[model samples]
Structure formats: structure tokens, C-alpha cells
Target: MSEDIEIAGEPSPPPAVKAKSRARTPTEIRLLARGHTKAALKVLVGLMRNDEATPAVRLSAANAILDRGWGKSAQPIESGEEGLETVHRVERIIVRPEDAVEGDADPKA
Candidate 1:
């Protein structure tokens, strides 16, 4: 009875806090940039589609649209095999002059 009363009087432990993920991910950055690009493209399309706009302004907008597709060069991604170990084999060969002459008559001597 006393132990139960003491336990009841004691406060419970605080709950465990979850660790926060503070680092920005590549996918998150890409999505954010995509949103900004889409917003810019919407404005550009509006400029190109407006009839009141000058031909030069509309032409510039049209060029912007086409440049997005073919202006930038393609980037090649470098990739290599993972979890692979390379092994090299080495061999040594030695031949002495006396050993070579032993097989011959050594006519010069």
C-alpha cells in the first residue's frame, strides 16, 4: 500500500523527443527550383501570348521558349561499378650473361 502510494506520488518521465532532419535533400532543392522555373515560364508564356505586346518582345519570349529546349549542352554523368576490388598480378624474370653463355660455346673466350 505504501509503495503504491509512493509510486503514485512520483511524476512520470518526460517523453522522448524525435531527432529533426535539418539537412536539405537534392530532391527537395530540385523540386523548389522546378517550382521557380515553372513560375518564370508562366510569365514568359504570358508575355509571348499577349497581343498588345510588341513583336520584338514576343519574339524574345519565343526565343526564350526554344532556348530552354536546345540552348544548353547535355551533361554526361560519370558512373563506376561499386563494391568491386581490383587485383594486380606481377611476374619477374632475370637472366645472367654467364647463364646465357653456358648454353653457348663462348667462342670469344
Candidate 2:
């Protein structure tokens, strides 16, 4: 979306866009992000190897690189009690932006 700015009493309208943009799928988003993975890893590696970085910051950078390469370690959930039952409750909510706002959404737009 383009932003329109109003200078003083004059209004500046942005150029009209002909094509509409649809939301990208998860795969598409991942592919787009993956394109920057090499650069991201390079930055991480630099941070991890930089002597000027704090030990904690360096450790964090190393961890990020390790996570990308080997994936995160599986975490085990613990009840932290002796023979105690840990019951989890799950709830799902769906929200529509058009319905959430009053008279803000246009079906044609």
C-alpha cells in the first residue's frame, strides 16, 4: 500500500496501482526469506566471530547459526510434580478484518 501525505493545506495523492496484491502463501514467504538466508548467516557468523562483541551476544549469534543449520533442540515439557497430570487446553479463534472494523473495509477495494 502506498502512503499519501498532505503538506500544509495541500493534499498529495499517491499514484494509483492497477494490480492488486494477494497474500503470499507460507511457502512463498519462506522462499522469499530463504533468499536472504546466506546474508543473514554471514552477519550471524561475523557477530559470533567478532572479538568486540560481548560474550553473551556472541553466544546468541552462534546459537542462531547453529539453529539454522541443525534446527532447534526438542524441548521436553515437564509437569514438575511427582506423578502429576498436565492437561492442556487449546482454543481456536478466527477473526475477519472486515467484520472487526466498522465501515472501514470496502469489498471492491
Candidate 3:
């Protein structure tokens, strides 16, 4: 019986060490009108690094960034009258003329 009870070649890691090896959850990312570009970039990088970010969330973030970066017009509806008004409203809300300028304009121009 003693001969059968041989010591293992390698010992198992401690419980705490095992727990520490577990994967971390990605933090929730948020972006607002202010600092939207920087925040979006950070979130993009985070999503690339973090295994926890779902494909849907990443796509949504990318879409948000593109929509904000470019002045994309709203989709027109088939109704063509009230639908057009709704589309205009969406364009007004999403697209900002102030945010269009990248930096200080030339005083000479």
C-alpha cells in the first residue's frame, strides 16, 4: 500500500493562484458628445485587447464612430413627405456643423 502511494512529479498550483489566472471582464465603455473621438478610439482599442467584448458591441461602437465622424444623412422613408421631415430631423440631431472643423481656421482666408 505504501509503495502504491507515490508522490506526484509536480504539485498543483494553489487555489488563489488558480483564481488569479481567471479572465477579467471588459469594463463598460461610454461615449458622449464631448470628447467623442478620443473616447471612441479608446473603446476601439479596448475592444481589440479585451476578449470579453462581444462582436455586436464592437460593431455598434464602430458604427457610432463612423456616424459621428462623417456627416451621413438620415435614411429617407417611402412616405416621402412626413418621412422626409423625420429624416431631416435626424440629420439635424446627428450632424453638427461646429464639430466639422478639425482645427483653427486660417485668419487670412
Candidate 4:
């Protein structure tokens, strides 16, 4: 036996909506750099080649591409073997103002 269902005056709940999937918006060149350097490089190259790109942006891209191609600015490399014993000799120049000859009337004197 089927039970009878009563449809009250209230309207039935709206149909479940399927969430829409949106394509990720294009990301900024800098932000893209953090995640994928190579991809960011491509974007930079594109920007450099694009005539529509602002002069500043194109210039920046050109600089960035050059930097990437030539490698980032020189970093002070700690040129030493880690966990290995090493000794370095440092020579420092000591200025002795008192050593000036007393009779030598320096212009400043």
C-alpha cells in the first residue's frame, strides 16, 4: 500500500543548483612568477613582444627577460665548504692619524 503524501500550500524547495566552475582569471606576472618561474618567463616574453602592452610594462618585461636569461644579479656566494674546516686571512689597514709628523704643518692644521 502506498502512503498518500499531502502537498501543503508551501512551495517545494527550489531545485539544487550545480555550482558553476569558473576558469581561473589570468594572474599577475609577479604572482605567477612565485609559482612557476618558467611560465612567468613566457608571460614576460609575451608582454615584451606585445605592442599593446604599455611601454613601461614592455620595458620591465624586457629587463626581466634579460635578467632571467643572464641569470639574476650576482649573489654573494659563501664560497666555502660547509661542515669543512677552513681558515681565511684578512688584512686590514689601520690609519694612524697620530703618526703624522708634528713639524709637517698639514693644511688642515
User: In TM-score terms, which candidate is top?
Assistant: 2
Q: Whole-model lDDT, candidate 2?
A: 0.87
What C-alpha lDDT do the candidate models reach, one value each?
0.82, 0.87, 0.62, 0.79
RMSD of each: 17.0, 19.6, 18.9, 18.6
lDDT string for model 1 (1-109, tens) is 5543547567977789899989889999889888799788988999999999999999999889888967955675545877566669898988665678556766457
TM-score, candidate number 1? 0.35
Model 4 lDDT per residue over 1-109, tens place: 3345547785767889999987655675557657787788888999999999899999999989888689878765565877665569999987566777778667565
Candidates, ranked, TM-score: 2, 1, 4, 3
Per-residue lDDT of model 2, residues 1-109, tens digit only = 3344556777666789899899999999999999998899899999999999999999999999889899999997787887887779999998776576776766557
Estimated TM-score for each candidate: 0.35, 0.55, 0.33, 0.35
| Ranking, lDDT, top scorer first | 2, 1, 4, 3
Model 2, stretches more than 4 Å misplaced? Answer: 1-20, 83-109
Q: Over the stretch 1-109, how does candidate 3's per-residue lDDT look in tens digits?
A: 5654647895655556444565544432332344476765787767755667888877776776666679566984577555354323434456455665677564446
Q: Against the true structure, candidate 4 has what lDDT?
A: 0.79
Misplaced by over 4 Å in model 3 are: 1-37, 48-51, 80-109
Report clash pairs, candidate 2.
none
